[model samples]
Target: MKTTRKILLSAGSVLVLLLTFYLVWANTGLGSETKQSLKIDATASYGDSSNKGNVVGIQAFVEPVDYASEANFRRKIRFYMEEAKKKNWLIPNKSIVVFPEYFGTWLVALQEKERIYSTPEIEEGMQTMVLRNAGRFLATFLKCPQDVQDKLKYSVFAMKAEVIARVYQDTFASLAKEYKVTIVGGSVLLPDPVVENGLLKTRGGLLYNTSVVFETDGTINPQLIKKAFPTADELGFICPVKPEAIPVFNTGAGKMGVLICADAWFSEAYQTLKSKSADFVITPSYSNGYGYWQQPWSGYSGSKTPEKAKADVGKISLGEAWVKYAMATRAKEEAGIKKGINVFLQGKLWNLGADGSTIVLSDSAHATPFVGKSALINLWL
Candidate 1:
């Protein structure tokens, strides 16, 4: 009887171990190959027929992220590129393409369980992810700054930093090379990211909103474009840099400056770009909450409203304020930046919805906002 009981106990232990391994594998494994057929939901273009100098802005309409695999997220981006080619906006070595802000930031959810996309709150989803990957998260959490107020965000970002950097870099670089156009790879929240010999390397620290420029040949520019302003939503987790000169990328089309969303609100950012002799500027932006643009203006969400921008508050809607106070009106008048495009990320992700239309500025004149589901706004330089 004792020997029989020992054999049964040993068998039960083995079965329990196998069950644990299977659960881990099911949650962590990248699922089967998935493909999506996407088409351009909306399209708008400005300037003359000459495609010599084309600046294409993809107002990508994204969905609840299912980074069950990297290719799942990448397919959406690939569809935009394919659609751009059909529209003839993609010119070899002669055009630059811009995507909306935070396009790459959601990559942190990559390889997470399917339930992460269905959670009512992002915090809940993140907590679930951390629990499932407790060992990995704990390893990174220990290395994080204990002094930071939001340890969850800091630790999560630290744990996923390397994967986020690698996937973000590889996705944009390959797209840039394949499309043969300069790409302003949208911003990603990373902890002290540095490009070493054209490779992205992250040294864990305070997370900064960073963007990278990929040349036509898929090589990354060594200079990192860090966002100097962080909105109220980002204050607790994201580190904002001191006001400094914005970086400009020399492309085949022209010397272009980039401002990530709220960065375009300040005059100093535009002035800094002007001093560098930028031919045009691109603002990759994202406005959260559905119909949030129609609501009353909330003043500057980042820092105190500049003296020049004080009068516009309360008088205009949030959407109008964006045009009046942001790049469309201010870029040209303040910094002689006559040509630029303000592109916003559209579509919904979990409970966080997106708004904002595409604003194209050319030859000192801006277009009426193109409020479409998903859009392509092109300006011929």
Candidate 2:
């Protein structure tokens, strides 16, 4: 009896050990599989020549609003993410880039507001005596450091940059965490604060117009160009950065090229991407409706009439610029078509072939409303 009991105990112990080993091995293998399947290598290239495989691009138009509201912004983003998740064409393993309109305005605004409220104006306003302070009210309420007040005046600009950064971070982080997709070429406005020279004591000095790039790893990439395009030594507009100047970074799954709205209008920018052997160019833009100049207006006689209009409305195309740029890029792949300098918006997605042939995978010309809501274009290569 004693020998039989010992034998049974030993066999039970060995069985328990085997079961533990199997569980550990299975869990470890499961982790490895998840990492391999879920993580995308965005830095992979399609070679130096014209793209050989399928390429996909998405243009998302974030609506324009006079003021920045975080709740509204978040809702809009959540809707887009849900839509992307639902789309059948969006591949879980493939790369995706989203172009958001006017991203810089929101970022700059948020920063400026934070700076302004940090001043002493809040305390001064609270301490005011209503009856006795009538004369001093304006002075006390308006009292701010001359330099500080000047800075506050442009707080709107600063808030724009801050909101943009927050939105990009939140949107990209959520989508990456939840959907496992990557966003490329997210936009931010860089402020150039005007600095007063110590000796000169002037009000305005340093101002900045910069577009920021966001990577998939929840970090912002360096500025593509310090000053994308400096204007009048005080303003910077969207301009093409040299391909060689762009620093190469892992985009998580596949290599991506970043471009702002105006940058897309320039051929040199596309050439730059081609030189870098980029697989896709992600473009973000803020475009107003096309026929602004031809919009109907009230006449001096107070009559609502088409005769009062300066130009024919139907003849003007608001989205012509985008169309032109798209066509030029497509034409580059055509055998006999000469390259044209004009920018076209040939709708959303175009697949460029090495044999100089092109296919329009998706076009949103008729589908997207002209009211500035966001739109998406997805294509498979």
Candidate 3:
């Protein structure tokens, strides 16, 4: 009887251990699956702009002499990437797009002059020379063949265009691998280089100021649209906001749109996003100076104190402008909580909610152009 009781106890102990192991294994798998399902995050980073600095154009001019070093640029990119990683906000299997202000026309012109123009022309062309040299350097870094480099010297614009496209492809591909997110918009610039129109011909034929969208699977979508604009004329470099541009916003698995600095200033762009059912609009602008525009108000004569006059003088106020506009545009349209629009100006990140409210997500002002770093934004529903 004693022997039998001991044997029964051992059997029960073995059964308990097996049950525990099964529960542990099942829960582990379940936990991972839950994490995967709950994955929802997005981010937008403004590429290369200045804050409280002198007025500069949006075109991709070579960095000012003060911040022209390659190391500086790399640091800026690295800092932004690190911030993205820390926020637990990096979306995997999604998209990340960079909007570098003034990238389109300048890059194209620089390359064209470098490869095809005469030596004297290059010397005299300030912007073109700077862009050409930068393109050559980037091409070399990417390990383009010497023969390709030689050819690029004459057809710099074409070569640079191809290089820019490839660079974005590779960068997105790398990010996709690391963070598991698909980078959507390729580097945007003025005037799409792939198209030719007579009226819009500014050196490189009729081109629409355009944005190129790149996919993570190594395929570029709407290749023709790279140079196609809904309302742009052939020779006109400007792309007037049109109702058709709105359709590009309807990206099914949560839409993403990149609006250059000027594009965001217009109400139509926001309306376009709404019409197309875009969930978020990433505005990357390079404003050289204060972009405040105000309307004059008529006033009746009234006495004011000297102190009040001093305080009011030289002060420009856009009272409730952003809020009113946002409410009218985004909220009234039933867009996501006013935070759908992510505005990245220079290195500052501002989260604009659907209600026309704003929250500063990151500020890199204290850090010099390249030395200081900022944090990334984590958007929660």
Per-residue alpha-carbon lDDT of model 3 for 119-153, expressed as tens digits? 23334443444344564545533443333323333
What TM-score would you give candidate 1 relative to the actual structure?
0.90
lDDT value for model 2: 0.36
Residue-level error in angstroms, candidate 3, position 125? 8.7
True lDDT of residue 54, candidate 2: 24
Model 1, 211-319: lDDT tens per residue?
8899999999998888888898887778877656478888888888999899988878988888888889998998898887878887999689877767878877888
Instruction: Itemize residue pairs with steric clashes in candidate 1.
Output: none
Q: Please list the residue runs of candidate 2 whose C-alpha ends up more than 4 Å from where it truly belongs after superposition.
A: 1-69, 107-155, 159-167, 192-217, 222-253, 289-318, 326-372
What 10-residue stretch in candidate 3 is worst by lDDT? 31-40
Model 1: lowest-lDDT 10 consecutive positions: 29-38
Return whichever of 1 and 3 wins on TM-score.
1
Best candidate according to lDDT: 1
Order of quality (TM-score): 1, 2, 3
- In order of appearance, the predictions have TM-scores of 0.90, 0.48, 0.46
